[model samples]
Target: MSCIPLTQKSSDFLISSLSQVNPFNDTSSIIKWIEYKNNQRFEVNKIPLSKIENWYFEETTGNLRHQSGKFFSIEGIRVETNAGPIKQWSQPIINQPEIGVLGILTKKFNGILYFLMQAKMEPGNINKVQLSPTVQATKSNYSRVHKGKVTKYLEYFLDKSKSWVLLDQLQSEQGGRFLRKRNRNIIIEVPSNEDVPVYEDYCWLTLGQIKNLLQYDNIVNMDTRTVISCIYYNCNGNDRYDIDRVNECIHYSPLIEDSPSGYYLDILKSAMKKDEGLSGMDDIRSWSTNLKTKYYLDVNSIPLREVEKWRHDEFNIYHEDGTFFRVIGASIDTDKREVGSWCQPLIEQIESGVVGFITKKINGILHFLVQAKVEPGNFDILEMAPTVQCITGSYKNEKPENQPKYLDLFLNPDQSVVRYHALQSEEGGRFYKEQNDYWIIEAGDEFPVEQPENFVWMTLGQITEFVKHNNYVNVEARSLISCIGLI
Candidate 1:
């Protein structure tokens, strides 16, 4: 990927905006940002938000006690596929019909752009609190709390004061297995002179600052990356390499380095000459929408049927064949949150899954080992997927000849060939608290590559480029790439 064209002054402005937070700034405020939660909690004389007697928790199923009546029941979905009748968990999809919005509130100050991030909490996050979107409100959340009162600056992005810029969109959630999900992605800019009050839970950050934080695992949350990746900064039109400018960039830039940045830029220029870039987002929209539609049009699978694998009581659910997930009920209370009190269901994983990619250099450029996976929910019957995605410890079901392509290489990974090895989470908000151990495995000329009926090895530059335009690279693949430190 060539450097998304940034001028010298703009680059400097971003680097300068990335200063460390001051601990003592506004120390007297009552609302606690998670960054200062420990410091505030240790203050022996601190004031409490509510009387302890007023807060409590209770577990309710079809009708749980002291729980929100909104999300009440859980059931199982049986989908008849070519493989078999796979029973999966099914719950209430989005409560409201209108698409929810996961928007970033940003502004420019002194020649630099700044993103507004919230220190928010979800019921299923591994950590109690993590960095979240400025406006992660659902259609229900907006109408309930923000419509008439409480949501002050929310008007600017909603419909009133002016500077709202939503980009080429329609980003979907990793199709909640048996369920579906999507949200409108917004990238807005408010005027610099506008005196927008910064809330206790919100903080401003620059692009450079955000990229720096990505180096450390999970600092910049997944929602943030999904939206940021939509940014199209490839606006330079010269269509030629400027070696002098590249050298100048290495001296003062925050991320650009001489050896790799320059070398990779040259590689991209030469490769792009041979590649036929996407027509635009039109192709992407079609690919995502028609994949499954195409699948149903061609192949015949087992039909969907309600089965006994799952049991539903008058007010609760139980799974007879428990291989997927377990649901637990909980009541949540927090003093510094937008919705300080609520009840919701949480998903807990029974076992961990594995995600890995096999890669090697082909014709002097990096090419990844890719797979074609057909999920019940895929728009097309089968879409491009990660090299190795299987439940941990179970790839032996292959019929001697049709086993998963590179199962052996991943099971026995050499440290020298592995790029990243860490446990990454599924969408905490939706999935019942599950995570997969992610890996990036490598193979070389010594280890021969295969071109099965559905697999192909493509250059790294090609993969990254296609991702920006469509669903060519699935979320699992994007998650692995987000961990890659290379720009």
Candidate 2:
């Protein structure tokens, strides 16, 4: 025989001729043969070759009952598929709903060949497994051989609607088999019409939420220092890179190295102007400073009082025109104090019925002592009755009793001492002693020089001056002889 050089077409013809001679027909018989080989090789006592052969005979001959008992026990065998382990019973049968019969056929049949038959018979209804997007994207990026073999044919199946083509088949070393590219293993395909719009909507909604949070005055007006510190503490050096790259696109610029204070102020002013609804920057700066200080103090186990003192010192930097800023800062400190220290004073006041009162005014604030006193008298002396009194005097005053007193007057500018005296007049008219002599005195006029026991005296003036001068307001003076007791 002459030697003939075989071309590509001739080689294919030869292979086709051999395949026709020993064609892959009768999947059940082939699977039974494979199972027999596996059983012999692995010594798997669970499914003997004899049982598989009988199952093949029953399936091919359409007489299933003969090997029912033997094949029925193999129904639960987990057949490995490219997608995952599918129960043998889950294998679809041609025009048959009996899962048990299908399972027997699967056990005795070549799984790949049976799957092809099922796919052909079911057509559109067969499962179209695919890889996840991440896997698909990765696989799309690079091509690599899997399991020591190159995938040549990229076979796919169309779903019912024919909208998506799923990668369902691949050429393996063994033969043509179901494909499961790792990247494509988890993929789910949706109609392009539905998924594209939904993804866009999700992105829009997410952006909207972020925009709304940024629109708030409190959030937008937050101090740049505090915000920067938080970003640094929370994100570390990563924030610097992010602020430069990501935040820059969003119009959030980082401070320049040599940026003047005026630049920051202008930025703040521009931000406020852009969003009229936002709180003033100065106001928010004060608030943010206090808030940051509080947060640090809370986290570091630092005392709140110490934090407040520091805040107070910071607030004192601004003048009166900066009162708003100062107040915001001080209010935070005061609120913290009230929350922390208010209970002590409340308890003391409830128990003792006497508490120091502090009042605030534009000119200044005042602190006074509240005293509870009782009077003992039978003549119904109004001056000696139990009263709630406010004792105000200079801190230098050692005796509060010697301080000037005013009655029934809410405001007084001057400090003066006055004496009240009464004299027993022979005539019906009222008399008072003056300079060691008895003289007639009117009701509203100043008293004479002499002092009388049966009278009341009161002094009115600035508390500091009265205390410094040792001025005594004779609020009330009654005759010791006329009253049985004095209080």
Candidate 3:
């Protein structure tokens, strides 16, 4: 297969990521627009699980399901995995069998690519509104399962005749909460001369502008981040360009120099340098494959009422010890959604989480420390995850030695080593007020190149390549990588 066309598109994306100036709206203007959307009439309040409209618990299996059985259902899954400390357990998971579309529309303006973003409101959002993908809808919603307004700009994705596909990949969502749920993380480029209509809630933004907003907390939603993370920017794919020549093709705007200690420049350099990684792609793949073979994940469906240690009341169903998350009900009323009013079940975490990635310069090229982790709901037995991905309750009272590998480094990190830190949210559609502390830490010079068997050092290019395929990179890792602010 030829990689020439993809390499050219990758180069264009890199330039857009570096360029700070956008022809349409500045970063501040985008913020003001989001604030405006947030002020619109939207309300969500917690109600009893038994009282949610058009949803009921199955009498036979005790599973929470929608009346029409189109959207999604809350079911119980018994998970037995050898990857983590816990061997077997049961929890409530979102059973959405339908694949969703998390697509971003793009067009070229003055040789720079601008992304179309929407200021959408989810029922469970803490901020009430955030920047979402242009079309974030499940197959059920797009096909009028809910019998509501049609999703705007969905034709470009459904009928490929209208646009050129730049990047498209099927990516997984939260494995812990979702049962092998995947979404189409796609980016399509429309011709410059196409007359695409712009609505009040949607706007065009450069990749640089989007990256700049990622520096803040809960501004860019999880769907947007995951879709953006699938974009691989290595112009040297298929050996099309030599190392020096590839560097020459990369142009960094002066705006990147204004960052603290030139960290943005370092990130840019790391992403563009596709060659000379710490480990070869063959080795990385073999390592992952071996992990997959070594570890085992067996998930079986069970009745929700039969789950162990979980208790249910009229309002919610939660673990007796208050561990990972709880299933509750929400009554939502919003003027902006496809359906004006609806009630559904939401998963509220016991506590906020910490998701971090540690990077180091290996042979003058930056490499991210990725762990091949196995969760119960993973489609495959293994997917590359962040170095530290854990909820507070998972290891709060555990001994320091028993905690996850490299957990203490982030817990008590040096201030200077912290490159990017923000309080980002999970998907607001099914999660309620759930936010996590996302971090990018630069490892000290003393950090060793050798890691555990399950962990490997990979360049950003390598990770991006894996992300292009299905079920290789987990959503948490994708979300963290999307926050790499090049601007």
Best by TM-score: 3
Q: Give one clash count per candidate, in the order shown.
A: 7, 13, 0
lDDT by residue (1-487, candidate 3, tens digit) is 1122877787778777876687589899888888888889999999999999999999999999999988899999898888777789998889999999999999888777889999999987889999999999999899987888999999988887778888878899988888999999889888889889998789999888899999988999999999999887665656322556555555443332233127766675666655568788888889899888899899999999888999999888999987888999999998898989989999999889889999999887789999988887789988999999999677877887768998878777899999899999999999999999999999978999889898999888788878988999999999999999765
User: Which predicted model would earn the best lDDT?
Assistant: 3
| Decoy 2 TM-score against native | 0.11
Write the candidate numbers in order of decreasing TM-score. Answer: 3, 1, 2
TM-score of each: 0.69, 0.11, 0.95
Tens digits of per-residue lDDT for model 2, 1-487: 1112223212221122112111333323433333343232111111222333323223432222223232111110112222112111111011111111010000101111011111100001011110001111113112331112221111121122422222111100100000111111111123323322211101111111211222221111111101111100101112111223322222332211121133222221221131121223244334334433332110111221222211223212111222111111101011111021100000000011101111111111111111111111111111211112222211123354433232212222122311111221110000001011111111222323222221211111111111111101101111111111000
Give the local distance difference test score of model 1: 0.50
Deviation (Å) of 110 in candidate 3: 1.9
Which regions of candidate 3 deviate over 4 angstroms? Answer: 1-4, 236-243, 252-261, 273-275
Report how far off residue 456 is in candidate 1 (Å). Answer: 3.3
Could you arrange the candidates by lDDT from highest to lowest?
Answer: 3, 1, 2
Model with the higher TM-score, candidate 1 or 2? 1
